[model samples]
Target: MELPHSTAPAADRPSVAHHRPGRARRTRPDHAAPRARRPLSAKVRRYLWYTAAAVGIYGASLAYAHLEEASHQAVQATNAAH
Candidate 1:
């Protein structure tokens, strides 16, 4: 009896030339600015949004750190006073 074939057929292999044919096509309009030349208003809005987010995060972190430091200091003072 013949053993069963374990290898794939010749047609199942991929050719090197066919690698990512769809990547060459441009999905965006060519007439539009390339993200860097956007209007100053748009840039300002984006910057403000980012700045607001950063400030919010920083404020939250500062508040948490201050609260933690105050709590630690209070505990230390109470322990020392005992």
Candidate 2:
């Protein structure tokens, strides 16, 4: 079976002259450069470091707790088997 052609004339159809096969149209001009980002303040940096240290300490504590519990269970099992 064949597909039906458009009833409208070629001139009446929407133009796609600006569109390319692979590339997209840019919203801004090509010559325009992006703005530079501002660096974090000393106070903000200190807080970030504090937050990181806290997270690290908490993770270490959790890992230590798990190791201690596993060791305790192994000891109990050994005692029960003897």
Candidate 3:
């Protein structure tokens, strides 16, 4: 629908940058910025942290299981002796 006092048509809008004929239009190439590279030491440090975390979790779970088994075996041994 056409609004009141709006003389210009919607299709005739000039909402874009106008490049002059004599000037070069600005352009961006695909590889304007090089891919960021993580330092070798930083990568190694990250893997080490991950390895440490996994090992810590595994060790904690193993210790818990061992403790539980030992307590159960001790209870059984005492019951058998009595």
Candidate 4:
């Protein structure tokens, strides 16, 4: 079978000097550095906290459902007795 070739010229190919699949690129200082990243704003941090809390609550509910059959049965019995 014929080998696949990149559309980019060899020189333009992403530098293998610091390249690996699933890893970040690290270029020489001579090359222009990438833009600086922004820090998380208060709103973003609050949203992350809320998301973590929601996941924790969901996991606790699932664990309770799996582990506490007695509580569920008591609730059913109470409803039936009413």
Candidate 5:
């Protein structure tokens, strides 16, 4: 069975508009100016570094505690077997 095709011309038919090859459509208009971002101050940067360091330390301590508990359990298992 053959599908019936529209006899209307290509321009007259309702179709989705295609973007040009290798060009992306912009979300914002070209005439709109972008907002300027402020740079972080020295004190704010220091605080961020301190917070990151504290988080890393806390994660390391938790990992160490888990490993310690695993080792303690293994020792107890060995003693029970003996």
Candidate 6:
């Protein structure tokens, strides 16, 4: 009986890495330090924070107005039925 020929050497299996079979390349290359970021001016920072607070307060007031209107409508509906 003739033996079948295998395509790859047993160690260089498709499931394994092209490098060492079990061991990974341990150490990563040290990257360059990140570029320093410019800090925002105090005026710009204060303006942005104030703008955010204004938007948040406006949104809350709008939501409260809608809830208040809905409650008033419900009260009117009950009054009409009585």
TM-score of 5: 0.57
The TM-score leader among the candidates is 2
Error of 2 at 38 (Å): 0.8
Relative to the unseen true structure, what is the C-alpha lDDT of residue 77 in candidate 2, on a scale of 0 to 100?
100
Evaluated at residue 22, the lDDT of candidate 1 is 77
Error of 1 at 74 (Å): 0.9
Using lDDT, give the best candidate's number.
2
Give, for candidate 4, the lowest lDDT window spanning 10 residues. Answer: 18-27
Clashes of 3: 0
Candidate 1: misplaced stretches above 4 Å? Answer: 1-40
CA lDDT of each candidate? 0.82, 0.86, 0.84, 0.81, 0.85, 0.84
Off by over 4 Å in 5: 1-34
| Candidate 3 residue pairs in clash (backbone atoms < 3 Å) | none
Model 6: per-residue Cα lDDT at residue 46: 100
Number of clashes in model 4? 0
Tell me the spans in candidate 2 whose CA falls farther than 4 Å from its real position: 1-35
Q: Give the TM-score of candidate 4.
A: 0.42
Query: What is the Cα-based TM-score of model 1?
Result: 0.43
Which residue pairs does candidate 6 place in steric collision?
none
Candidate 6, residues 1-82, lDDT tens digits: the string is 6455565567665664557744475644655766679999999999999999999999999999999999999999999999
Higher TM-score: candidate 2 or 3? 2
- Which order, best to worst by lDDT? 2, 5, 3, 6, 1, 4
Q: Rank by TM-score, highest first.
A: 2, 5, 6, 3, 1, 4
Residue 80's C-alpha lDDT in candidate 5? 100
TM-score of each: 0.43, 0.58, 0.44, 0.42, 0.57, 0.52
For candidate 2, which ten residues in a row score worst on lDDT?
21-30
RMSD of each: 9.5, 8.2, 8.9, 10.1, 10.3, 10.5
